[model samples]
Target: MRRPLARSWTNWLLALGLSLSGHAFAAHAYAQFGDIRYPASFTHFSYANPAAPKGGEIVLVPPTRQSNFDKYNPFTLKGSAPPSMLGMMFDTLLVGNMDESTTAYGLLASDVSVAKDRMSVTFQIHPQARFQNGDPVLASDVRHSFERLTSKQAAPQYRTYFGEVKGATVLAERSIRFDFVRPNSELPLIVGSLPVFSAKWGLQGEGPKATHKPLDQMVVDIPIASGPYRLGPVQFGKDVTYVRDPQYWAKDLNVRKGQFNFDRITYKIYKDSTAQLEAFKAGEFDYMQSFIAREWARAFTGRAFERGELIKAELPHGNAGDFQGFLFNTRRDKFQDVRVRQAIALAMDFEWLNRQLFYNAYSRVRGYFVASDFEAKGRPGPDELALLLPLRAKLPAAVFEQDVPQPPQTALDPTSGHTLRDHLRQARDLLKDAGWTYRDGALRNAKGQSLSIEFLDSSGSMGRVVTPFAKNLEKLGIQVQYKVIDFALLQKRMDVFDFDIISNRTVGSEAPGTELLERYGSRSADVEGSGNVIGLKDPAVDALLDKVVSATSRPELVTSLRALDRVLRHGHYVVPHWYGAVHRVSWRAKAFARPADLPRFYQPEKLVTTVWWSPHASAAPAAQITQPAPKAP
Candidate 1:
């Protein structure tokens, strides 16, 4: 879902509270709301320890279920690249701090300047920046990276993300400018975040015979880029290691001063979660962030734990909750009716699952933007109403008449007499009203077509979670098929929107903008490999997305999002799941040291690999560990 800003890019920056129209001068950093926390002279981020030693080989498992990897080009759509390829091997023009949500400081670029008309932005490459091959990073390299990424061979999300940028121009050897199709304030930051690489990459042979391979065809080709790490040893699909570059161009840069502390970071591949946990107990990995509450509560214990060798701890942060749920494919006829979707959603008994399996470790997710200001709460406020009024005809009356929609409550309420039986009755009634009735042995439509759902997943562990729900659906006479396939097949099917129902999680955003378009926009719904996996294609949602991106202030942005959230909830596109408040993690004790000041917003694994340092790293003449910031699960 990573893409450049387009359409409302200018308005999005304005909504961030940036006061700009013209006559903007270059600066060391750019903040969404024009409020830069760290001054230009700041040494390092507060979350990082500049004086800490760095030297360690931390072996960790992939954050998500990555059974294996097949390609080196992460930008392409065809194959799976190894974990941490996005963060470890590429350098962006700007880098964000762990504590901030929307501010980014110069990384490859020393400074950035916006055009007076707000239609373009220019950046000067850091003079000392050099690629892995020791060639200086130039404006031409930036242009090449942008063009290559936007090409058809790359993933379609890249095009949808960078669709707003008109073109890129190399103003000088070290200066490049990005022209926007519209005057978008956020366009500068979006373009600044482009992953730059050496043009020599993918080029084969020498002189005239050197043929440049298409980005997708460059599979398994080692990347040549300016970053803190280089591709290290690999056991093909079994494991991969990243080695830190001692001569990394930005080793002393302010943005990188105390980060990427590991000398060698290895990712061990395990197809099964049970095997992964067993291996971790056997000292196969240095750190692990566990998501399964059963494993965290019961299994994170052994001889290593009693001897203080393995430590299990919970880390706290103020990040937004993930929007996890069982998303229904609206593009399919079975889920087209809102009543039917709501009926299906009513079958999930979160209370029973929380009490029995989860050990009461998670909170039921209610809305798309839960635990955030953008979340829709009570009836639309005046600001939200003002935005929603114009599209009254396109919206459901429930959005304006009712409070924010809540998942079916299985807990007993003496006053309302609500329970799991009541929920099942409501589901049955809703299905009947939607032209479905129990006939023969299953719920069937007018044509005797049975209502069926295949709960598709890549992990076998999901069976425990989906079994109870499937049983509840069976009570409603709906056929439930739970299938756990391999990760690669699951990914390929997902790319083509080839599933009836699938469980997925989307990361929450603090300053959400154009990315919303790719998630729920009508144009992106048809684009294969786009984030709109639920196949939502609503004109009303599309209009709300525009309002969200074009919002002029923080209040306006919040209002627009609230309105959008209300509409999305009313649509019943997903059956909400649950989220944990604290990050549950386990690590080998006495292996790493971290700064006392914790970041306000950060993933557990990112903090572990990037900010934590080794006590004996400086002991060696040149530590060879490479730190990688893998995504949070």
Candidate 2:
């Protein structure tokens, strides 16, 4: 049976330490500690304590998507795409919460302080923090890192994140100060998450080459980081290894005081999830994060669960936001009508799909925006509104109002099957109101144009999830053409905004920051390689995003976020899909000891690839396993 949720603060704290301890022991021989200062005894199962012995290699087999480590150059990388690579090669000023949020704590930097006006922030770098080559990390390096990232030669994604920094100056040998043109409360969090690179090493290439490069041509051989691990050996298109840094600085800082227990980590690449899962079952890989629930339920039968060989836990994912959804491209005239969007949402039978396809292991989301507990829960209190009402007095009234009402609980029930029919009727009525008519069993507009929509979906499970929705639209006298494409082509089309409707997956961060601006802001619509694949361009969203980025207090930030969420919900830009409960990962019980504080959401900071280990694994003899076929529906 699973452990019960902690009922008290003490219990929660104890549980957190215990969980972290479990992970440290299973992965590496490490020591455990109750406090930060005192040294603790090392044990074979002591993986939670930072003082633990750090030697042993762990092999990780991710469900899908291989490591893009070859493209780890500081100036050229985009998105969080380089974190896994950088996590091994370099360290950032601050790191993400294990749960994967924008709220960063100090890593290379010991602490950060923001001015009351939020225009200026100061970072106190750890004196011992040094690059892999033993050069001390200085304020100059921080300034150089920011300057290169913001320069015109950098990728657009990297430039947008640091464009808010008005100036960066070295205040002291171990300190850097950043002044923002406008008050930006989220600046520290954003900068902290960005890996700091060696100024001397990064400035050598083309003096800063900009434009995009093919994934294959990007460089990954030499990496410079101040973190606990440095890049070991990486074979392109095969595997990347991370070896522990004996002279790592900030290994004893409060934030990183109890982490990075594994001595070495190896990430093996597999093109498909089925192949990856089969490799896990045959013990070629030590762990597999399960995404297909039906397969998991069947595999963890009598012996698997009874023997404690297979572990399943419901991780409270604070950063796991709204269900993955289908986004409509408003740029297309066919999807311009709200009725068409509603009709498409209504005709789909989520009840049948969830029960049959997902084994009822997911939750349906009705809102465009989702919030974690760390995020704004609902309407802000009076104090919060006071701070926000001044900056956003002229904002849309919809921002303050909960415009999109969630479907009734009964309507959300997949077993009832009546909600879809009811919504379908409403869709039909709305279409008629929008001057669309059903004639000869087909929907037509006033211009005598047949109502047809083309949806782009990636091949495999993603395509399967979208197929039912396409059929549902057909039943409503609407034509939906499904175009299945490979992941590469799908990514390219999304980057260029070339699709009508696209089904994609997005994982939200715990601390909702400006990264979201790229997804919904007007300015981001035209930014090349941005995540705003749907091309959303609303002045209201822009204003809300600005408020979210600049709010000084937690209350003010929450209020601003809720207001922004209300607007996005009313707009109905995307039809929400499903959310998994926990990260279902299957691993060899005999291999590595699990951490006490296993992450709820896997991000660059909390990846098992950086921390897990296998005491029995060795380089002398390679184990081989055959790939398995895709799981049957």
Candidate 3:
């Protein structure tokens, strides 16, 4: 997760030419901690099969829980965009292979070099790289992309994500340099991951009559980019298809060789998982990854599954467990106190929910970085103390005095001496101490304001999951309302931090950096459309985030993250949920073939779109790839 820098792009552009020389050499690959896996001459990633045949179409549902997409521009804040567009239709300067944690190989850029002072990174664009219209990619286009993404017209999060980078400058027709505010190891990868698109995208009319729409207003304009696929067929809100470009520029590039095997990919939208599951059983799509344990266990059955026409498999991954939980917006005055937050969190009985609802398919999430080395364990060590001691005045006593906080447990395991009743009693006591007394059939604060909670979400599928938690909150005399709204409205409310509570899962990364700042930094807390969904504004947290991003080594990064984790866990800002170690996926048998070696970290959509291919597809097969859908207005 990257964050916006404090300074404006104009400031950085003016600060260019500060007398710094680029490094004497360049490399085909770069890594955060100086650990590069593949050599410069390597053919393709070990996880990809170069010989994989590619003419077939593979249909899949959106990996996320979105019901419909309303915009083609994903960078805007107003509406939900199709999840498939960014990855399929946009190209980045550098791309990271799934097998490696932090290493990046040049994609659009052929050579990359970092300044000796570490304040800048330069890239030489590939001359062969061309947009869908066959125009060559230029340094000016890279600069245009950076400026556009960091501008106010785009989502505010990008400004915060690229906040450290002063600005991008075109050194030559095919060369560009990005100047950072300070020396940081992660800055190179930060800028490298930038999604670059043609400057001509989203333009209407021609010559004097031409007009360029703001990113948010380009709702249906097809994006012109240098990606492997182009927007093919669309049914406005129901489904979208992507057709592989026959003249894709980097088809033979060393880093891209066996990937993006599908000639055509289609994504179907459904209102709910039940409908999606029925459609999958009816062969409406080729694959589905089930997040609901009950659906995977009880509902994924029929003659098609019995006869092995559909295969159910749990594919294990080494990626960190994504932090899924009920995030409390601290911006609200009702949740301002730490004790009140702590009291509310205790009402969630994860042990009961996992046993009764999830069918023991998950483990309780311990912290923000669960299942990763960054997750703080037991107590702070000497290194953590060295970092935490300086900010002790601004932090809570629990940061240093207590062990890492754990979710309240019940007597699901006999040895765990507590029960749900005991936990609720504890919650009641905490609420009382916080001046919230249960009277008038409600938990009222000293001013007689009833403590109310609205659990906001876009889908009703989580109604069952929240029911038990709501029941527990009701016991405390709290007014709990779980409202399910449309995705666009939900997004709009979330942007302004308008809800009391929302359940979200921040995707985990092997090498987490700038993204942490966006999620927890004080600078981002008040920024609308920012990733700081929790409304965290602690200066101590802000200090630690700087250290995490600027750390020079892997050990240093881990130590900083662990300390930060301990501080965040002590805040009690979230009601931690459960996570599964493997993906519960069911795909049509004989429809596709995958590589023998599984990448250590990947999502279901990535695996399906990137490395999997149809076994029977031919170069000139006579199959209609997709049904013509209604065009966008």
Candidate 4:
């Protein structure tokens, strides 16, 4: 799922939406697409078994790590930290349903409401919700959390995310409200997902005598939060552990019932995927989500697996498989031309790569949102045309005249069969049309600049993946060089948008919200650290994004996103990569048990952590008969 735009923002901006009936009222859960699934009086989530026993450890080595996290805080940009820091250390106002895309049920806040004008969303904090140190979670604490996240002291991405919120207000003792700059349905949900922490977290003491230090300066101080788990032990870069809170508040809440079952959840850190997977095979860890196709196929086939000590399950879902591709940094003068980008895209033979390198584990990424309802198929239909017609003069003639652009398949001669050679010939025409002619044995533009691509990446294996494409570019008299560097240096370069080409992936979400602005907005195109790493700036894209955000219904959202997907595909922003429709997971057997039913759309890690609990007291993966991942939908 490392393809250009892989969808995993499910947990980042967790599920939300509401019943518009009677303007607004307190509800157990909110869903964007339809009626709420669980009733207000529901005992536990349908996906969770309330009777499942807890009290065993679940060990894991993640596919990636920030490495050497000195700070316990994840809100700031100064340093990196371990995963689940937000949810484990601090509890959000609402817990998003793992099964639903964006449905949110109250966690800390017992009830919530929004003004009819949508200018403000109010939440009534549960009196029972208490922090780790036994302090009540107050309305002021909620305000403090929101103010800190949106302030200049925090990460810039947070400012962009909560930009619509004017400010947080303490309406009363337990009631808190967030005032928005604009009245939008999404604003309430966004604010509802905020992680609430006690004000005493960074402050020294209670009342006016408390001395507050800047949050970014915290090196290794433990966070004072009210979540089910608190920081247990830390070993710097090696690993971190969370001990389940025995006196944790809201343990029996309807939304939280049967969730967070483990007595201790420890996330181990490894240098690379190879080491991590090896650690899992050796039983150093209990669970892993494998990212490498080769490892999944060949590496997990030892005696442990044969003896039922290990299990590999590919869980499938209907979540959108967003694009992951090689991005051309358009900020560079050489890559400004669309034709040149198209030629580069044409050179990446995913069809051949799938058969050879990937063992047919992935499908070629055709458009921005493949494997979902949002992807563009066939010619522009009448509904899509209505949206495109207004911008006809500003768009490409091909947008109206031709079918959407798709990467060429295997091209072979009937008698003297050859595939990639035909692709290279086609690429030659594109570069030639763009005035990059093969003269003096080099492809040079009219300005006398030789065409060269500098592919920058942190992964050493990426160089091998792009090697075949580079050779095809070389056949067209174009220079292609792969640069593999340190992860830290790569992050710095990526922040400043200082690369010719990058084999990068963007995290996508089920519901595309204001985050789209950070990824593709014109303002973020120049901002360092913004998600718009490709430096994409287009009026048409900007317009489409607006349409995407303003969509009012599921049907409207699909229509708008599909139209946006088509336009972005037409822009040739990247060379489509490959994506796996199902989540690849391998875990230790007989340690855990889960509900027979599974949520249709879910992040595998979230599901396991929350719903599954250990039946074996000795500590192992505590889940039921493994449900193998279904074929891609």
Candidate 5:
């Protein structure tokens, strides 16, 4: 018999111990030590280095085009990309990590409990939690928010998530209860991560009707939130400002007691990243979130670094999820063969991309689900396996062993051409098995149809990465073509499932939830507005995902998740890409303070609204730590 991956009982015991002990080191159980740094004055708040800075109009540059906050309601927007940063600004309930860990720590609620049957969940509302307008947060508001979010008139995305909530009823002034048709252990985690809008504000109109106005008009003109910052002026093509909420709730919560220090958080919009970098160098912006590895590698050599205008801070890889390498348009007849998919995965030279483009700044991932605990290795020891077996029974064995490439003993250096050649040979073999034979100088099927693939890339950086894949495919007698389209057009094509293969990045969550359903469930495959863009559907995979959402204990959840991950990998649904294991962030050193315990990934939604304080401003003293009075019953 195979060794168990992890024992459910032992895993639970360990998790319980870690949660109760308040051990800082235990929080990083799965993380490996590299170049992660923590400032001496940093506290484990939502923001990093609370004492670093306090006042400045720090400008943040978003990775995409100017956000369409005015036209889109986050709850309704459905696409491959994560929710807009603006949507995150409007609400806060839960936060996610890159590795798929979703945490429920926020202003309104501290802890959430789901009963054994998963029928009902009780949220312990924070006593001090109040809306931006200084109105006490009531259970009625929570209920109202849910009701509106789930209503058909609201955005469809919000409605889909709340579909599981059979009914939401207010239990008391401070407690709201959710009744579900089936057991779902992930209920609390999911609901808590949803940003809660004031029912009064969101529902304002005749008889709960939703007015789909632009976000700037709804949020900025009349700002209302319980989060760290309130909406400010919207300067089209220039900057959007977020003013600190003076009467913000959670000001005294243990997790966020000393964060959100910036008086004004500004997002300076740029048409392209190169221009953004130029502005960062010119001190036009206070910080730059680096997506272009080549640009980041050359920053130090630029004029910006010589004058001490920029500081490169390496952040611990918080659990923002993976950037997936997808086998797009699975519905296309050309990609029906799994062998073909595997061949495509092998042909791409991620090693070269990492070295030449990324300057050896990233770590290649071989699996769909990245394991957090680096020490656990394969299956947990026998003792741990015993506890995991029951959960494993509900899932496929493939979860533990399928399609996982052997972990590299030495980090791959993309600069080495020898490694690239070996990878190429492996790819060719996989393709040959899939019925593509080299005839004359071109690869073709027995019927003489030439092997061809079109790579749809939306961004310049992704286009550059796909260019080399074309060469590798050509070597194997396969014709490959790449084209870059506008972001909007790409989105439209994705909606209709109209492409052969596309290269794009998806933000991973720290905790896996409905996203799994959206990506792999049969029900989601052709759902008109859902995110199962690749149209994957398998009963075994569905069963594993169901078990994951229903699992009550950590061990049970991990086992089910591991199984689901394995099946996806073995199926070659996605060709894995790279993660730096750290955030490549450059911020104005003197503009804002850093917090001690920073999230693995610094998402704009999570960081922009919280813990970003300006150094020159007079907000609150960093040491004024005090617990709020117990919430009233």
Candidate 6:
């Protein structure tokens, strides 16, 4: 998952250049790797249709566990916000093209430059950039965005993401500079993705005097940021609509062109997935990105398909596969033992679950950053060894002595010897070795403490998914309890790192940067609401994370990540889950159309909101259409 890059770099990339005074070196675009598909003079993104139509509204049921939204603010950690709030209202300094994974073109900032020392990056605000209230996007606004996001008032992820940034300075009326803690290659691009909004947002406008309020208390405040849309209407906690701005400043920009096509986008909040899918069948919404394999295979049939009003398609994407599993909160004493964690993981009969529950719709998730260059496979190479060798004392011997551990395979056929029984036997052995044994009905430690687990969740809908695993744990003499609490309550619990195990995942990145620290770093392990849910605090992991963030080249980055993957795998922080081969989706056929070339790496809602348009409107319609969601990013 996309994480934060926070700290002083151990190995700063040294690119030679002269940091001359008043020597402005500007570019219209920037790439993590030095390849830009669209030149500076380009008028539109390759994936967007310049003349696509707008006007028709698209209503959707969000794929979140929360049934309703209580806030307009999307950046906070407390409450849920509508899906269209962030992308529709706020704009970032740069916008990455979907076709290419690592390139970003100017969005809010017209020109961007990096200092020769790579210690700072500068941005010149676009002359045409304007807020929804018609205020010009000033240098102060950029600084305000950075300050507020990195401050205590905003969400912890922002602070963790931009933590390495030393400070944001207003260079001029239309220019700003962001100085870094160290000169890293990806810092500029990371800073470019910062969401910029008018400082006037979340203010208490008393007559003519708008009083500034802290971001933490600005939960339900209406935002005044500039984007394609503004808050149109709301039905309390039921639904929220975003109205497209007719005079949006960046509407004609090359980076925008044919995006944000709908005149109005609405979201209907449903408490249950079954109800949500039924609503789609009844034409209450335009699209449904189904995650339940049973619902996708069985429920998406009947009248709509028979009348050619609905379409179901499995869309392919090349994005990094998202890792989802039972994330162990390592802060808990019971989970601190690696052998106990390993033993518990051995009991997930994925083969049996795949055939019985998921209709064999998933492939085993092998490792973090799976299907990417970062995933550790086969053996540790010479480059990875260089990094891993120094941390041998902090890591397990198996990391250097053997290939990374793969998930335990259970045979699908009845006659095969490799089955649940075989893996359970291995699990018993590991548990015995870890000083745990079946005693007085439950596994007890040396202190006579029985192994107890609570599968913490929100909405209680995942009981079916956890039931089998809990049953398996019961087989190993473990006390298993499952409880589904409120979403807000769960968030509160996770923030304080108070949990036994939680079903969670991270949004993976194409080129993982310092954000690796926020995920597994020692510093973030104790930080409340930090993404390091596993509470991983190994010095070897922290060191490898530092290497991954500051790597000058792709080879070095991959090597560092492999070293990290090996270490974490051996640690067994989470039970590896499964991934889908394709994004399974069901959308209304006659409503919207998309670009000829679908983006290789994208989320389902992202594709619908950004590129898809309605043919019923006056302008030219985009051709082709889309799939579902699963990727972390």
Give the alpha carbon lDDT tens digit for every residue of 349-386 in model 2.
66667887888987776565554533333554564455
TM-score of each: 0.94, 0.78, 0.94, 0.89, 0.76, 0.92
List where candidate 6 sits over 4 angstroms from the true fold. 1-25, 203-211, 413-417, 459-461, 618-633
For candidate 5, give the lDDT of residue 154.
50
Q: Write the per-residue lDDT of candidate 3 for residues 401-446, one digit (tens) a residue.
A: 8899999988876565888888889889988988999889899998
Candidate 1 structure quality by residue, lDDT tens digits, 137-224: 9999999999999998899888878877999999999999999888665677788889999989998889988888889888877888
Q: Name model 4 segments beyond 4 Å from true.
A: 1-22, 204-211, 411-418, 439-441, 618-633
Maximum-lDDT candidate = 3
Of 4 and 5, the candidate ahead on TM-score is 4
Kindly indicate the candidate among 1 and 5 with the higher lDDT.
Answer: 1
| Candidate 1 backbone collisions, by pair | 9-184, 10-184, 10-185, 54-617, 55-617, 263-624, 263-625, 263-626, 264-625, 264-626
Worst 10 residues of 1 by lDDT: 624-633
Query: All candidates: CA RMSD in angstroms?
Result: 4.5, 8.9, 5.5, 7.0, 8.4, 5.9
- What's each prediction's clash count? 10, 18, 10, 17, 45, 7
Residue 293 error, candidate 1, Å: 1.1
Candidate 4's residue-wise lDDT over 1-633, tens digit each?
312222222331233344445445455554544335566678887888888777787887654442545567788766566677786667888777765665688888888776756677888999899998899999999999888887777767777888778998898989998888876656767888888887887887777888877776655666777888877656765577777777779889988788888987888876565666787889898988866677688887898999989988888776667568888899998888898888787787777788778888998788876677788876788888878888788788888788888777774343555377676787789888889998887899888889888988765667668889888888888888888776667767888888998876654467776778778888788877778877988887788777776655666677777778888888898988888888898889966677788776677877888889877676433233112112111
Candidate 5 lDDT over 207-310, as tens digits, reads: 55655443323332333457666555555324556666555666545445555666666677665656667777778877766766787777535655667666
Screening candidate 6 with a backbone cut-off below 3 angstroms (N, C-alpha, C), the clashing residue pairs are 1-507, 1-508, 2-507, 3-515, 4-515, 5-514, 507-632
Question: Candidate 5 has what TM-score?
Answer: 0.76
Give the runs in model 3 whose Cα sits over 4 Å from its true position.
Answer: 1-25, 204-211, 413-416, 618-631
Candidate 4 vs candidate 5: the lDDT winner is 4
User: Between candidates 1 and 2, which one is better according to lDDT?
Assistant: 1
Task: Tell me the spans in candidate 2 whose CA falls farther than 4 Å from its real position.
Answer: 1-47, 63-70, 74-83, 99-104, 202-221, 252-254, 299-323, 369-403, 407-417, 438-442, 447-449, 597-607, 610-633
